[model samples]
Target chain A: MWQYEKKLQYPVKIANPNPKLAQLIITQYGGPDGELGASLRYLSQRYSMPYAEVKGLLTDIGTEELAHLEMICAMVHQLTRNLSEEEIKGTPFANYFVDHTTGVYPVAASSVPWRAEYIASKGDIITDLHEDLAAEQKARTTYDNLIRMVDDPDVLDPLRFLRQRELNHYQRFGEALRLTSDRLNEKNFYSFNPSFDKHCNK
Target chain B: MAMKERIYAYDFAIVEMNLYLDTHPEDKDALCLFHQYQEKREQLIEAYEAQFGPYISNVNDVQGDKFTWICDPWPWEYSKEV
Candidate 1:
């Protein structure tokens, strides 16, 4: 059961409205390596995780990803708020404007709608953890790309914070992988699917 | 700082401590901090809800529910107001 917390995990206050930047940052909100996908993937995978530590990691990180999702939405909201009609028609966001009209929508920078196919839930602990680790790196890289593109300190501050969080989550996921591996057979970690096979006897 | 700001601070500390405790569950000091702030958070929530409005549902006995949990002037809205 989750309780409502009315505060963002990290504050996002963008003073200037730049439609071009909004078009780019919207990617994090619903792009291929978006936080929405990350949150759903880990939360779904946790149900089948074999060990307590890994499950806890997935739950915690997945919850954090939800927080990230909120921050990204906040960014998009503040960025696109109160745009003039001319600004909308002059910028690339004119296309998005026609559809969303200053509303927050989850679509990639390329204008692709968010899809469940962006994430994988294999139900295997090893497979899921590896996927999670890779996901973190991908997210970090996306943030890096965003950081390079934007010069506004307002946007950059939160982007840096989010990037750091991805690194921290990567470290925690690595620990989860180690904890899971330690319990498996020393001879062959791949001998069985600990989540499904009752014979492993961890 | 305003009461809302104080509550936000407490909640932020609790969140950071929570993430730490998840990975280091056996760490006694982190556990202690988490419990301490959790209680502080609950107390602040109670006090704030009594004085200002309900930030959390049913943490304190709020009067005459019109389903104010979905009320306007949300926390994010308050930040902008500040």
Candidate 2:
């Protein structure tokens, strides 16, 4: 069961509206390595995770990513809100405005719409944990890129918070991998895929 | 910060502490802090809903001529200039 919390993980208060920056930031909103993907990836992968701790980790981290997604959307919304038609005319946001008209649409800075194909929920425990580790690194790199591009302090604050969270998630997922690996046969780590080959593991 | 904003801050602290406690169940200090924040959060929510509207959906018994539970200025709209 999920409970709704009325606050964002980190507050996004951008006093200045920069559509150009918003275009880049939107990538993390719906892009391949974005929070939305991160949330969906862990949540979908949890069902097949072999251990209770790992499954619980996936649920907690996935829920946090959902909050992160909301924070990113809030940043994008504040940055693009109330844009003058003239301000939008000669900006990269022109294309986005044409389609969304200041509304928050889930698409990358490259304008690629979010797709389910970006994530995987391989039923194998080890494979999914490895993927989770990689996904966290990818998200951190994306945040690094966004931090380098934006000069606004307001925007940078929340982005830094999110970047720190990616590092935290990476650590958690790494620990989960270790925990799962420890449960497997020490002589042959890959003796069996615990998720699918349950009979041999027990 | 406003009263509502303070309540949000406390709620966020509780949520963060809860996640930490989830993975580190043996951490006594962190567990203590989580309880502290939880208490603060409950107090803030109670005060806010008393003065304003329902912050939590489960406790929405305070009725009025207008359904303050379903009013404007949602959480997203709070602190935002939109």
Candidate 3:
């Protein structure tokens, strides 16, 4: 069960509010590579995970993605909070507002909504764990690019926190991949189901 | 409780239960904990719907009302303004 701490994991303070930059950065909030999809991808993939550790890793990292989702939403919200309809509509945010009404929606910068196509859940422990590792790297790269584009230290603070988390999750996912590899029969990959009891997999 | 924060916690708990159960499904004590967590989740969802808005997104269509709850504030509103 979750417990709320009544405070941010880290505080977000924008010395300035730039709705235009907010519009672009929000892609990380809901974009294909964004935190929301990452959380959903891992959480939903846990069902068929062959090993307990992989399933556990998905859950922990998925939960952290949810936290990252909160942080990204906080960034976008704080960036756009004080803008007027005229000001918001006047800038790049105008298109976003037309679609989401300043809501923390999940969409790419091109205005494409997030889709299940963003990530895959292969279900095989090795395959899924590998995908998770790659997902973390992809997300880390996205954050890196966003950091380059964003000049605000206020924005960068949380971005740095998020980047650090991505590194940690990557490390865990890498560990999960290794564990899954060890579980696989060194002889062959075809008979992954020979040992475990089928009736009790659930 | 603030609606969004409570709902967030509720979802977090569900995911937490799902994860714990993934590893400890046979533990009766853990199962009990899962049930307790779920019951609390149901209560919170109801409270959130009654006080704030529907719990699901997009609950307008007749078939849509099938989902019952929709559209709480997004998570960012609960954060302190930067």
Error of 1 at A31 (Å): 0.5
TM-scores of the candidates are 0.87, 0.88, 0.67
In the range B1-82, model 1's lDDT, one tens digit per residue, is 7776677788778767776676678999999889999899888878887887656534343459565556554433324443
Scored against the true structure, residue A173 in model 1 reaches a CA lDDT of: 84
Better of 1 and 2 by lDDT: 1
Candidate ranking under TM-score, highest first, comes to 2, 1, 3
Best TM-score among the predictions, by candidate number: 2
Cα-based lDDT at residue A83, candidate 3 = 73
* DockQ of every candidate: 0.33, 0.32, 0.11
Give residue A78's error in model 3 in angstroms: 0.8
Across all models, the iRMS values in order are 3.2, 3.6, 7.4
Q: lDDT for every model?
A: 0.82, 0.82, 0.70
- Compute the DockQ of candidate 2: 0.32
Q: Tell me the tens digit of each residue's lDDT in model 3 across B1-82.
A: 5665565565566655565555455779878877887888788778766775654433341334353332334434543432
Clashing pairs in 2: none
Candidate 3 structure lDDT: 0.70
Which window of ten consecutive residues has the lowest lDDT sum in model 2 chain B?
B73-82
The most accurate candidate by DockQ is 1
Q: After superposition, how far is residue B52 of candidate 3 from its true place, in Å?
A: 28
